[model samples]
Target: MKPAAFDYHRPDSVEEAVSLLAELGEDAKILAGGQSLVPMLSLRLAFFDHLIDISRLDELKGIERRGDALWIGAGTTDATVGADRQVSAAVPLLTRVTPFVGHFQIRNRGTFGGSIAHADPAAEYPTVALTLDAVMEAVSPRGRREIAAADFFTGLWETALEPDEVLTGVRFPLSNSRSGFGVHEFARRHGDFAIAGSVVAVRLEEDRVSHCAIGLMGLGSTPRRAAAAEAAVLGMPLGELDPKQIGELAMSGLDDVPADLQGSASYRARVGAVMTARAWTDAVAEAGGEATHA
Candidate 1:
């Protein structure tokens, strides 16, 4: 199916794009990498009368260190992000998870902000952002505002972004020396959308687990944090930190898991638990602690 006819506008700058969006209101949509949007449009799954092309806007295309966080421009492509040395060093989880975003061709054109704004629960970027508590920065005629990752995603393909607002960049906090990150997802095949997945960051304090963050994907309406599971493992001694039990606790409190053609709710929960456990083990080991049932 072909996308319905629409007006295309190429704006010179982000301010111009924002102005176009504000002026066009509900009729317009921002066109960044077009990896996701183009597919939806081609399938006739979504319709917008006007597409404001901001793909070449220089203002929205850079990666830089901003204080304690790394700032990634909204228009920056996944390929660029995956290849960046600073991103790999400062935010290892993001780099490690990038290979799962899609094929290299797709990653070549899929924008970092586009994936986040698309708000796909199963996508690697959203889970990473949520796991790191990355802050989303947006602009509008009103001015610039920052939204915490927790508050950014509202529901399936939905976000807190207003109609006239444009996502400018995302700020991910830098990892500490004591922290280690890992990601695991259970996809049926390589590069496929995961049925269940987990991204974890763990910080160790001597012989105990000092802090842990767990983000589960493809198991809820939105990428979710395993807060209860994280809390269960906190202060656990290295010898007592069992990844399998951590996995179970991660699945225990999930009430809104989806059941569909991919798998039943119970099946997905099991996968989620396994993924979480594997990721936990990786994270714990990297954090200089060994996880074992003993």
Candidate 2:
């Protein structure tokens, strides 16, 4: 199958892109890396009357730090993000999770903002963004605004972005010296979408867990914060934490786990528990806290 006929507009600047989007309205789709959008178009899963190519817009093409957060351009590729020294230092969880995104070729073409905009429930970037409370910046002819990661994702492949808005970039809060991160997922093969996954960020204060954030993927309509699990480990001594118990708590509130050929809802819930536990345990260790369980 091939995508329906469409007009192509490549804008050199974000202002031009926003103007095009505003003019084209619902008929326009912003083309970034094309990693996910192209496939959907080719399969007839999606169609647009116009494609506004912002892939080369200079405004969306760098990795930089501003104040307390690291800002990543919407056009930055996954491979570039994974290899960036600044990202490795400021948001290590992104570095740790990027390798699991897709194959090398996919990573080379997949853009950070594209994945987030696509909003796949099992995508690595969204899970990381949610766990870190990343903020998404979007622009339209009307104006510009920021959307919190927690409120950005509305459902599978759906986001808070208005039809005329183009995501410009995302900002991730820098992790402190006492922070550690870990991510774990179950996929039948490398490069495949995860069947279930977990991302954990732990902040230690005086050998006690001060802050914990757990994000669960591939188990619901959108990547979900494991609130129950995060609350469970608060103020607990690192060594005394039980991975099994933490894992159970993570899945306790997952009532809408998806079921497909990959697995049943019950199966995914079970795998989710295991992944959550492993992620939590490894995150604690990475944060310089001792973990008794392997």
Which segments of model 1 are wrong by more than 4 Å?
A: none
TM-score for predicted model 1 compared with the true structure? 0.98
TM-score of each: 0.98, 0.98
RMSD of each: 1.0, 0.9
lDDT of 1 by residue, 83-170 (tens): 9999999999999999998899999998999999999999999999999999999999999999999999999989999999999999
Q: Write the per-residue lDDT of candidate 2 for residues 101-171, one digit (tens) a residue.
A: 89999999889999999999999999899989999999988899999999999998999999889999999
Candidate 1 contains a number of clashing pairs equal to: 0
lDDT of each: 0.92, 0.92
